[model samples]
Target: MKQDTPTPLQEADDSGFAVRVTQSAKSVAAKVLPVSSGATALLFGVVMFLVTFGMVMVFAASSVDSVRSEQNILSVVFRQGLFTFFGIPLMLIAARVKEGFYRRVAVWGVLLGIALQCLVFTPLGDEYGGNRNWIRFGDFVSIQPSEFVKLALAVWIGFVLSRKGGRVREFIPAWIPVAPVAILAIGLVMLGRDFGTVVIMVALVFGAMFIAGVKIRHLLAPLIVVSVVAVPIVLSSPSRVRRIQHFFDGCTEAEYYAGCWQQLHGTWAMSGGGVLGVGLGNSRAKWNWLPEADSDYIFAIIAEELGMIGAITVLLLYAVMTYAFIRIIREAQSPFTKIVTGAVMVWIVGQAFVNIAVVLGLLPVLGVPLPLVSAGGSQTLATLLAIGVVLALARSDRQSSQDGEAPEDVRLAVRAEGRA
Candidate 1:
């Protein structure tokens, strides 16, 4: 066959395809590249590593349970992976959103979060482990709305406090809409009886407020009120009371088979791992001896299988993440970015601390998952989305700095607003 030269139309078509491909490649590269600050890149990398490690751990920790429950061995990990698949893109999309967009939606986000949480009181509500905090779509799908509530509360607090400027130092101006709305969001979760989440939310609010420059004296009043309120709530539930007593007084012999089962097993798992762990996928605790082996107590599984080295490595990763958040907060031009980043830091890192502490028997069994390392879809997706918001803030600050506007100029503007 003779190879004929292309006609003008064919040549035009080929050129068009080549240009399209080039443009497409550039677009993809733009999305993939870390063209922002070092903090953004570091945060992204740390998150990805945690997520991947979590998936592996979830697989290892959940396999025996899956087999015992007569489900496919891959079922838990596959579900976790599926959420990660969706979450990573959601995170990227969130990172690309403008700060103005978050400000515009902050109030509405809080409202929507509250609405979703309220669904747990309706027929759609589902209960697990004594807390009614989930909305079930059917047998196959259920979501914990409190996870999204934490994000909304963080954004709302940042928006309100940032706008308040120097007024944040005053009581009425600082707490007015922010404190009330936050209380409502947290109270709804409290109604669900998930005190663990409530505790984290409290930390998030205080962290944001402190970062935004609220007076320490003002915080003390609320601190006392929260302490007073928490006591009654803790005493209201017999199970809660028992867990608290077990934490302070230590577990008795009869209680070991009852209320202290999870804690005792968790301690054993941690001790069994020694320094280097038994090796991945070799945890004896996951064989039904430990409750929530893949979620709340996943760190114990890490200890049992990966040992002290693996466990410490995970802690170091979180420490690195904390540093990234601090970098972003320090470099951000806007008060909102700093406040929001601080709130998210407290939420994720504080929750991780709480989870790890519970596993180590320093705290009671709180039923909180290990952030990105747990086998829970809602917790993972919500956490990734929060990180995306922080990334967006970091990139915005980076762009502002690169545009030749000095940090002093931004500070002067804020000071001018405060004077006004």
Candidate 2:
């Protein structure tokens, strides 16, 4: 009787019908799309291109320095290559971490960063170039904890200012904690005698506060205070004072070379690069004329070897990356995402511009790197890691927006769509 109720053909047809319905439901579930495609794709492409370009330049710029020092032409290139290899994978992993997790971690993150900074005062600290900010692990490996501190402090400020739904105006409840923490962080870095990094950290804090909706008046008072104090610090040191005095001196003046040796050499390196550049790896300044050719002054080397075209190319890449990151902040589902991305963008772009301008004689030398382009292991890896976090935020924001949900509140939602 049961067998007679339905034939084999009818049963097979019923199974096919069920399969179609299930697939149709899945199709409807997956229909949502991101609000903006330009932000994600364009930014991703630009950053990826810049990283690759940086890797190429690292090989070119560091090769000579390597051969001259270690007698191995590939020594620096090999190390850079290794870091790039690790950095790429690390970036991919960071891109997958939850945005909420990044937000929550800011609390402990800042604390850890401060602790690491304190380590510099301990025996673990190593002095280099008159700055005791570096942490030496061995002959060839070490980390600059101050570099990581910049990112952690930025995130913390963003989180703090954005707390209670972006109400950063309350002086006692809000600004009190942030200002003291920031001052402490800055004071620690200044103790290392790295005014450049301290300036960068201050910039990051201000940028975060700005994005968190803090009033200009509130932020400016501290900025003015820091500047007034920094002037005396700069004046107290003979070399730093001379460097400052000579920066204002005319480029034609004799004191320019004697007093501003690094800046002058950097300018010469850039000017030597005409329309098309001397050629990759052919920098005349790398012959020890331009100091720190591979680090703070890499942009000058780039201009010297690649010309105006190459220099613009690098800047354009940065512009594209910055634009993409800004879009991410705009489309972000929450203030936290916006502030974090903004802080990072300002740090990377701001530092790059300062470094380039200094080399061009438009600004005083700040002793900062060109982000991912500069040939420092800890710096390059840390930068790539931060970029990865940005990418993660972008991806998470895209997903949340498509679902018509807040980035922090998004979760699985299921609904049945039935059709006859």
TM-score of each: 0.90, 0.85
RMSD, model 1, all Cα superposed? 6.1
lDDT per residue (tens digit) for residues 1-420 in model 2: 455678889999999999999999767633322113577667657766777777777777777777889999788778877888898788777777877888789889888988988988988899988888887766777788888888788778766655535346644545768888988888898999887888788888888877777777877887788789988888877777766767787455466567667777888889999989999888888876777887789898889899999999988988887888788888787666788889888888888888788788887777888888877777778777777777777777777878878646222111111210
Local accuracy by lDDT, each model: 0.90, 0.77
Global local distance difference test of model 1: 0.90
Model 1 TM-score, all chains together: 0.90
Candidate 2 ranges beyond 4 A from true positions: 1-37, 172-174, 251-253, 409-420
